[model samples]
Target: MKALRRPSTAVNALLALLIVGAAFWGWTLLKDTDSDTGANASGLRTLTVEQGTVTKTVEADGSVESASTATATFGTAGTVTAIKVKVGDKVTSGQLLARVDDTGAARSLDLAEANLDAAEDALGRAQDAGTDTSSATNEVAQAELAVDEAEAAVAGTKLTAPMAGTVTAVNGTLGGSSSGAEGSGFLDIADLGKLQITAAFSEADATELKEGQAATVTWNALQGAETTGQVVAVDPTATTDDSVVTYGVTVSLPNPPDGAKPGQTVTVSVITGNVENAVLINSAAVTTTGNRHVVTVVGTGNQQETRQVQVGLEGDDAYQITSGLTAGERVVIPTSTTTSSTSNSNNSGPGGFMGGGGGAPPGGR
Candidate 1:
């Protein structure tokens, strides 16, 4: 049998070159893969964990309404006489708001006065007689009673204001009609300065709400300005309107300026409580898993740790981390990080690559 011939040095050199090149190529491919994978796993996430007040507010959108609202209807019934106040008139207590005709009342008053005088004269004469004057005594007593009725009738002819407030509405037009009473007002009065918010909240959500519960208010008319108040009253019964049940909530609003009217809708936000001295963090940093709360933290240089956090309250974009975080420690915002699918190995070569034996074997000799 003939011996196998060995190739020349040039061919040997070329073969060596090919081997080196193959190794380099393999390492390069792995380096790219590792790099890609690492990029996916570890990312730069920016977070905001600072000191701030975290209010647990039950937020709902509603409209602004007059705090001091009133539907003024006269207590005594009468004809629509002369209504002195208009829609925006300010009235003081005891001010004469309107006048009902005193025609019948005046006539009755005059008659009663005459009857009462005649009664007094008969009573004196009967007393002087000092003997069986029972008939005159009875007649005098009847006349005295008639006088009282007449005086009462005249007193019922004037309409007066019951409260010092703004005239929000006027029910009857002057010279329109007349019914007949005293103290019956055709005008509505409301104290705009002492306004209260009457909000219609869903009954289910309003269960925990009670008197003096702190709240914040917003208005469509006044943007960027919020007022604070307390829950003054709550109606337990559900106010159902067309199958939708709601509860009436009264919030004492801040002192308002002059000329405020009722029936305007206002927005109310009931703040149940506040979390103080809490470890606040961006809401985006939080992640949930099967009722567990967690957050991903960026540790020392490309290292990341997942930690469980105790949360107290949640705002629109922030959360109160009651535990698991400290001041000045960094966290991820989740927005700054990007996820990658592939990973690259940067363990071997200069820029990051892989090398020989444990890797894929070359072709057979």
Candidate 2:
């Protein structure tokens, strides 16, 4: 050492002041961090469980089609002389829809009628003269059969509607021979008022659906049109398309949207189950722990305990508590913010707290 010298009074006084200032700053930082930790520890959100309704549903999409449809083809080959009904015309059963050229058929009928009259006269004369009337009788019967055949040929040229429905297609042309080609049908008729949706559901979803179950139908084309319907039929056999197995579930709409035509696509929601007056809680409150449903419940004293629960009728947002939980119980709804804050507090360095274990400041009462 160069010399043993005492520090000046001013220098010693300045060092003392600097040490106190540094200590105060460190104290302020510790107090702030402690306050932050206390606030975060008590900041936990909770939800009160109560009675509510939950509806379990199965959703699928489908297209709307006529419940009953029919296509009328020509019965006989002839020139389409007249087409009485046009597309969209409502027709009744046995209504005359179209007619063909029956001139040749009429002529045959007339010729057959004349031959039958002559044969009857011959039979009457034979009976009056008593000369072998049996042969005349046979000739008259043959003439009667020929007339019936001619009448049938004439009737085959006319086309008629088989049922009462709206005409959807008309493929016949005037003066065109009824060759019955691809475009040769008289017309198509369908019962538009009675509509149905053939919805396809996956194998797992179809199992819960049964005939007579209620369903709701929606179509984008109709602008939020919703109609009540029921499941009319479910195909027992499954249909596979593009490696996906699905089943056809027929839902019938008793009253479809006005002007809703066939082939419009629709979505179907089938209600499988509805639970009422059940204890419900937020779905996030439920957690799976080793084959058990666990939920964290906060007691009156602000203490938390994990308990196993039985859930029923899972809904879109909440779940029904079947057992191990009751109405009016409070359940904890964990949040990311609270979790992050807690993690930061646990990972705090040695300097974070007033003391290592949140002890009082140094030299404090």
Q: lDDT: which candidate is best?
A: 2
Best by TM-score: 2
Instruction: Report the Cα RMSD per candidate.
Output: 14.8, 13.2
lDDT of 1 at 3: 35
lDDT computed for candidate 2: 0.76
Error of 1 at 46 (Å): 9.1
Give the per-residue lDDT digits (tens) of candidate 1, residues 209-248. Answer: 8888888777656556667888888886777899988888
Shift in Å, residue 266, candidate 2: 2.2
Task: Tell me the deviation in Å of residue 328 in model 1.
Answer: 8.2
Candidate 1, which segments miss by more than 4 Å at Cα? Answer: 1-52, 61-81, 131-146, 179-185, 223-225, 255-261, 280-311, 314-365
